[model samples]
Target chain A: MSELLLQKKHSSYYYVKSKLSTGLPLFAAIFLVLLIALLLLHFIWHGAPGITWAFLTEAPRNNNTEGGIFPAIYGTVFLVFIMSLLGVPIGTATAIYLSEYARQQSFFSRSVRFGVNTLAGVPSIVFGLFGVGFFVQFIGKGIDTAAQTTIWSKPSLIWAAATLSVLTLPVVIVAVEEALRNVPQDLREASLALGATKWQTIWRVVLPNSLTGILTGTILAIGRGAGEVAPVIFVGAVYSLPQLPDSLADQFMHMGYHIYVLATQSPNAADALPLQYASTLVLLILAFSLNLTAAYIRLRIRRSHK
Target chain B: MSSNSTLYKKSKFRPFEAIIEWIIRLTASFSIIIIFLIFIFIFKEAGGLIFGTAKELKPKKAVSEKVQDKSEEKVKPEIYNPETGEIVKIVEVKKLVKAKETESQSIWANLFSDTWQPVGKKPKYGIQPLLIGTFKVTLVSLLFATPLSILAAIYCAFFAKAWIRDIIKPTVEVLAGFPSVVLGFFCLVTVVQGVYSTTQFLQPLCTNIADIISWILPFSDRWIHSALTISDFHYSAVVGGIGLGLAVIPIIFTISEDALSAVPNSYREASLALGATESETAFKVMLPAALPGVVAAILLGIGRAFGETMIALMATGNAALFSWNIFHPVRTLAATIGSETGEVQWGSLHYNILFFLGILLFLVSFIINALTELFVKKYLSKKFQGA
Candidate 1:
């Protein structure tokens, strides 16, 4: 009887140990989910009240402690728009070359892949430095020297957009390539079997199918580009601008930079707290909506393909 | 049928197609060119300092002497006759000799010293404190993020049902979507206050633990005492690290979850068939198989945290303090560049130093990526070869 009791105790102890181990990881996952929820709630709770139509439409007044963030919003939109125009086509073409044309493991393809990976890993601040050194000092100054004008030699919207396009290139390439790879080999084979040329098959069959994916890539790149402030800090972003940018040559305000300046450098930061929260809220909503749309498109593609 | 035959005949020598393909290939190679351009341009800016060719160095002695004379004149107690516009009395100051000692030191000595004051009359461009700050913040962030992410990854990979997985995955992606600046703002506005209070509450408990550890292990007393003491909690490395950890968690989680799920089902079955518990199979068989990927994920996460700028700039107090206390305010390399590079003269020594820090950040991330690539390749080969 005692031996049986001891055996029962041992089994109970093992059962409790197993339960504890599983419980620990589950608790961790729950913790992370709750943390995210709490963060979002905190932002919305404080920031939602400050968000109004006027707040989104008018320019800041009184040393950026009052009024709205209209100029920053405009600049951010313009920045990302230019970035996508420059980045998407090149990224899509590169993705096509990698997925549809280049032989796997070829030296050139491998080198290109390595370059993409390295570019993805590079820090944003270094990108800013590169922008200043290459775009502002080198190319911009080169243009100025040729034109005999000082317009291009300083930080401006064009240089910032160019730098951001470079930064977002890897994101677009990865997304578009994944989308291209999802197009089945049988479809490509069938197109080629019909006596269609390689370019015709790709342009007709592959590109059509991956159009949503390419759109997704562009949206993702835009989302990333809109939110990034470091690369714009030296290239074009200013703390405050009295007027909206008229051209790519003009320096402009950015949402992220505006928030940063308000949080760190405002003369009366406490008084500006509501404006800071409201600005962060707007930026967050923009980024989240863009990311969600891209994710939704990606999910639909995956489901349809399956 | 006649039109189709004509089209086929026309497609036989499609010059446009060949040209388009070549253009596509060239555009694909632009990534490679851009990478080289980034390296060359950044290095070009830093080359002045690295090669000692900056024009600032040529007039260093004259500049230092001018600074010295100005500093001495300010320190001296002098009486001025306003009508005559001349000094009637002057007292010699001893600070002149000490200033001379610092000014005469070699550039390398100043570069490696503990201070990071780059804007003063006699600028000291020491980089040690920034390096230490970056190291401390990265270490704290890794400590906070790695285990939590890994555990969550394990649960999502091996334990969670399909429905739960769907919810958790999207939530993590939302977290990932948060802009770093937003995270920095959150930390500045809310998290620092929360952390400060929490640390203040935990101080006594930590002191008690330190005392017990010192009593239990005499050899570890000094370091443990220093490590556990939370003197001040405002805008510290610990707070900055937590902010950064929030940024890093999603990257580590997604990669690690993919790796863990990629572990074949056969290993799970084999372990289970041997009477191992479900958790046991996950811990022993699946995790070991996915070790390479998990390690690669962690390295990538480290790379992300190491060079993250806005969070470090906003949350870490930007003090450039040389201390091991996790609760002490610290400044990082990227933060220094972000804050100082704006107003600095384009071709100044301070600008070159910031670029030098950029070079350091670039090299570190490059090495991390190369290492991660090596691990991923090794894992892929092993899996395909049925090792």
Candidate 2:
């Protein structure tokens, strides 16, 4: 080393002190270790089963030897569909109201944000309670009496869907708001300068720009709706109903709750094992894919906008 | 032209803008309507158990009273088999027994019993055991998880290097992706097995170790080694604590990390420039600054751990002991409510009890969340002011 450089480095206490500021590696080490451990456990415990069309379509059997999670998979898909239909537009509109139109810093708007945040933090069980009390009972009335087509035939699915939608709506609104906020204010001003009405500016410019983010958030909310077991169990989920719901009113089974029950309550070791893992895999895949799709859209939009 | 426009605008705000403002204001106000509706529905569903049920439950209560009265009855019934006939008539003996039996069902009356025998001839739905179990598991979990998460956050926020921070931030969040069922499975298949065995092996070893330590310290051998028994550590509060802890670790880590990072860098720099070490700056300076948010994280973490269903359902043995012993089995409200949903008929007392459990859960987490929000709001308000 050069004598001048060597002297300066040795003379300064800053060099020694700078080395002490390393917490990042520690954090990374812990995180990676935990993730790897969890993944390894998941893969190791959940053995790959031979997936067949028969396995995916058949019902659980009288004996604990052969059955697929067809009913559960069917139920989860229906749930995600309902949650998306109910949550998407309402959440998008709410986000638009918060970000584009409203001065959310105002007291009224601030309180609204507070409510949304509180709702977000409320436990899943509380949502279950609400689902049971509201959807299954109060709202179940008109739909419950169909009596012909579904196990529940009349009421449960719509109510559960509505409840799940509201439960996840806050997250959608927040994500959508963030996405909308990411739209540069200059774009809005430019539109206004061209004599566009506020609604026209928002619809033509702000919303189109934010669509990617809004979709991502909406999908994320759906993923949450999919994995949930607690509230839906109370509001819906009949015990191991053998058949799939032919219609909305048809009573349903669920993957998450099924896994919970099979693993905890049922003693069908070999039979339920593969089915549980497969069902879990299906639910995880659904959640992951939805999240990934939304994330991909957001990334694409962001790149173009940038 | 600008002055004319300004004068026109100053004379009165535009009616269209005013209307738009009102619309915006109304949308914000709508959340209140949402909360109210939620409360109304939850209370109504839960309300059936409280005010609406008199037939099934009330008759059971009367039956129980008759049973109790019979147990204390002084007189006996005379036998009546005067003729060999198809009709079988027996005279009642103890009025008290009949009164108690008429008053309530044993199963229904003992809903608060520490033991849960849901499938017995005299089915019991004693949720007290489950509630106690829930409490033990939750308390243990929060105890285990809260500290580690907060510490991890603090270290990451103030002390970690660049590459480590980047990796840790997202990596820690992976916990969020691990579904609850997966976690429950892990606890049941792996963790429970590990704990059960470890408790067995460690009992003698732990007792010896404790005994040895106690000899050096103040306690006696019997107390220390007995503590080491397999029963002491197997399926104990510690296992549930660890599982629950893992479940909520990311939640606490994320929130606390944000709060810690939100503390101004200037303060850390200033404290460090005064010759205090980086550790001192983190411990004495940033932590105190981020205390409120950290507290919020802990409270929310507590709430999460408390309400967590799947983990407790799979891991805890669901024993309903009122005893505060950590080694014994515990039942929680969520788990019992969850497991019973399939078995219990809708509108039954057990079903109502589940709703009641939901009410308890709602009331608790609501308070925790309210406090968390209040703390976070105040913390941020103070934080921004300081900044």
Candidate 3:
């Protein structure tokens, strides 16, 4: 009878232990779910109703208390366009150099890698300062002195785009390098054996295959550049710029900066609440869609390779 | 199989390969050049403030005869005129700084103090308050966020079913991609309201605790009152901390989850086979193995919190004061630079000061990142070696 009681006690203890372990992890999973649910619910409940056609196509009226954010949208699109134009090619080239040309353990390659890593870790505010000091002051002043004009001696879209490109370069390089390295070594060897030169093989075989991945990187960069406000605030973003930028030298409005200005600097935060939420929604959708597309492309590539 | 054949093949594409390779090398070197330029330009502006230009040397002749000859003083007076002027007056004017500094507090001296008055007759560029403010907010954020992120990471890495894991991972990562400006706005509007009321809701409990403590100590009531205010809570360090905590959770979660998942499955199997519970295996076996990665993740999260700009700027009320109170508003280094750099004069002392703040941020983040990278590299190599 004592032995039977001991067996029953041990079974109960094991049952309780198993139940406790499962319950703990379940609680953690629930907590994560609740957080994500709260974020989505908050944004959609507050923001989705404000996203109307009038909100999208029209410019702000009455000190941004009314109308849509057309100029802010246009400015963000233009900035991303210019940023990609500058960031993608150079980023792709650098990745190719790292993966294909430079020896893995070479000093130059290590330094380049270190530079990319350091640049990646530098704060966005520092990038803003660098933009103002280097692009707006030194290089812009040099250009002004050379041309005997004041055209490029201040914050402008070009300077902001350039700063953002530098900020996102590491992202692009990592993505592109992964893509380049994913191309099978046997394919490159086969191309070389078929009398194709190294550059010819790279240009014809490797780059063509990795173009989708490179595009994915550019898309990711655009998504990041679109959302970043700190790097462009002092460099080029304007609070009440009513029109689309006519040239790269013109200061532009941005969705992120506009939200910040409206939320913090507005006279009537209550009245501007709808606009702020709507602008945030637009920015969220933009960044989300871009990220999703890149993720999808990466997934497709991975699947195809398998 | 002949060396000559290989040599001939190499020679065929030597010129093309050389030019293409040079272009690639140039593109790669451009990143290094840009990084160096960032260092150079920031320091150049910051250095200008530390060392100003030379003093003006005016040749002022000391009238030996005490004659009031202002006009003759302008000209070099002759040695034998009625009185000889032999002395020089060197008027050493102070360098043009951004703010008018009083004679008592030097810039270096002011930085060690708690006051951060940057625009006035006696402008004080005290970094102590900002540092304290940063530390307070970061501490609050990490305290609130680290456990949540770590537990969630463990759940995702070990316990979540496959479909649930797929949904949870991307959804959380979506939070990571959300713009900080939006997060700042949300904090300004929603989170601040939530935090204020939550603090207010805890008033009775706080008073109870304070009452309990007051029985032991005479000054507990005053300390509690100062620590927990009944009302008047608006934009504050607590609000900023919550906002920053939200911003950092995704980073910490993603990194820590990766670290947890990178632990070898054999460890889990062995622990399970030895009759250990799953939680025991996870908490005892896996967590210890992934401790380096976890440390690296937390350090990266702290680095991110230190450099975060928009949330702190919008939510922290931009008040620079000397208080250890978490309920009061405080400014940060990143926010100060973000808000002030736009209006500051290009070559003024204030502009250079902002650049100096940038340098401080750069250096701090650099050190944190270097340490994090060191630990992360070790973790990755250890994982790869199957040990």
The best candidate by DockQ is 3
Lowest lDDT block of 10, candidate 2 chain B:
B1-10
Minimum summed lDDT over a 10-residue window in model 1 chain B is located at B1-10
After the best TM-score superposition of candidate 1, give how far the Cα of residue B122 lies from its true spot, in angstroms. 1.5
Models ranked on lDDT: 1, 3, 2
Local accuracy of candidate 1 as per-residue lDDT tens digits, B142-181: 9999999999999999999999999898999999999999
Q: Candidate 2's residue-wise lDDT over B264-380, tens digit each? A: 888888999987777768878888888888888888888888888777767777665666667776777877776676567666666766777777777787789888888988767
Q: Give me the runs in candidate 3 sitting further than 4 Å from their true place.
A: A1-25, B1-13, B52-105, B219-221, B228-231, B383-386
Tens digit of per-residue lDDT, candidate 3, span B158-228: 88789989988988888889888988888898888888888778888877777778778876668766675
* TM-score between model 2 and native: 0.81
Docking class of 3: medium
Highest lDDT: which candidate?
A: 1
Model 1 TM-score? 0.90
DockQ of each: 0.49, 0.29, 0.50
- Stretches of candidate 2 off by over 4 Å are A1-32, A49-64, A105-107, A142-155, A238-243, A296-306, B1-31, B57-128, B209-236
- Of 1 and 2, the candidate ahead on lDDT is 1
lDDT for each candidate structure: 0.89, 0.70, 0.83
